[model samples]
Target: MGFPDDTPPGLAGVLATLRGDVEPSSLWATLVDLAIRGVASVHCCKGALLSGGKEYLLRWNESSSLAPWEQEAIALLEGKRKGTEREVSLLSLFQTLAFGSKGYRKALEGSLEGAGLWSRERESQRKRVLLISLLLLFLGLAAFVVGLIGADAWLGLPGARAAVAALLAGAGVGAMVLFLPYLLVGALSSSLTDQGYRRGLQWRAAAKALKEELKGEGFNVERWGGDRFPAYSIALNLTDAFQEAVKKGKITAAPPWFSTALADKAEVVQFGALIALMTASSTGSAAGVGGGGCSAAGGGSGGAG
Candidate 1:
């Protein structure tokens, strides 16, 4: 089958290649390969497979070096299998591959917003501490000056010089004691602000990398309200020209069993999901083959606040 007349060249081209004269077994193998490549591209997990008829298992590649927060975010995703090394649900894995870095992007966005807020707050606190410290020092110096002048005028003797010196020393010592705590607090707050700023920058850099990766894959990528808002938002519009081709009967739908078998045997369930997607695309049916349609491939946000 051929793509619809209006299909975009990028997507149409990919579908045309996939739908070329090939055996069902060969098609399945191709899908499996694509699925593995897709997962590896994001460096999230190795692959996924159906397990026990009702569940899907996603395996994490131990070789992949993930950030601590990334690991935590994956753990929080639904269908996580405890005690298993980096295994998640087939559905979750499928969503991740189909969408490409949405989960990580979302997590990074939230972290960036939080860190920014903390940095701002800490900066304000440090300023306040410095102001208070300066005020105390100034008041102490002013009082010492007054005491020196009063001693000279009232005592009118050499002994008054000693008294004035003692007074000055005591005032200096008191000022130092009062300033120390505030100075320490100011330093602490400044350090905290720097740390928060660094964290925010890290998150932004990670999100930017993910966005660039998706763009490299030919997805239409857009960033919205980042400059105006703390939580930077991203939107991905997948080239659905392939879906349009399927809907127009320009491509042949994969066999239902093909989707099922692919889902069951592939290391990553995304391959099976893509196969199922093909069935839905070709038939122009919202109904999925073995399970649901791969319509989730459409662009969407991980969310921002």
Candidate 2:
């Protein structure tokens, strides 16, 4: 009832009469109810029409459930007398019809195309953020691990512990000053580059192609005819080429096994299971149960020692 002034006065009057039966305070709720119960395809006979520039395009698909009574009701709504069923009989009598049933199809196709483009852009942005965060955590941990392993090996030298300690300390200082900072910078630049890769102009081009595909399908006409927007599901079949490119990148940019959080958590659980299994197996063979500290042999040749 609160629609803009552009709405037909007759339509407004009809709405006003309908609303008068409801409580005055429930006008907003009544409108909301109407919006929620948005129009559905009533009958296949009541098809959508599409207007393509100056030409009037009509596409008619008869519903299997269409009844003679419903057809009569449509004719009555069209101000036609209840008589014949065939179009040829009606056409012979009247020849001034301007619009056909296919007009609704054209309008629906354009709307669905625009929706597809919008959803793609949103998904691309979401992937970019997730990829950048992963890159950051991985590179940071790699730098930290290199620092730990280098210290462990260098500082554990045999007959020159003090000298080895001094060397490892100097190496640690150098890593903090030079290598760590470089790693941070490299990680930052690479993340930006990778995110930019997915945001390439190619995705936009693909979305444009999808829009064209929908337009070609003649699905646009009846799709947007009702109050509810119609959706056209488009499946992209780019697996082979896309996965090949991703596989090639993985050869160069694959994160270490320990870098991923999910992998690390799984590894922790697996390690516990492995230890439990080994202990059970060894104890079963020895005929002992739940004991500790079995000496393990070092792989070396020390015969007389």
- For model 1, the stretches where C-alpha displacement exceeds 4 angstroms are 1-56, 67-69, 77-79, 82-86, 91-106, 110-239, 242-260, 263-305
Any runs in candidate 2 off by more than 4 Å, and if so which? Answer: 1-113, 116-119, 156-305
Cα RMSD, each candidate: 20.3, 33.3
Q: Candidate 1 deviates by what RMSD?
A: 20.3
Candidate 1, residues 1-305, lDDT tens digits: the string is 11112211211222222211111222222222222322211111222233222322333333244433344334444234444334344444444333333344344334433544233354466678888888887877776777666665657466557687568757866897789788776654432334444433444354344345443443321231111111111111121432332344433343221122223333234323343443333223322222232222222111100
TM-score of 2: 0.17
Model 2, span 1-305: residue lDDT tens: 11122211111221222211111111111111122232111100111222111110111122344223223222322343222321111221112122221222222222222433123343345456556555554554555566566557666566665454555555545545554454444333321123323332333344244345343433232222222111111011122222232233311222111111123234333222222222222123211112111111211111100
lDDT of each: 0.36, 0.26
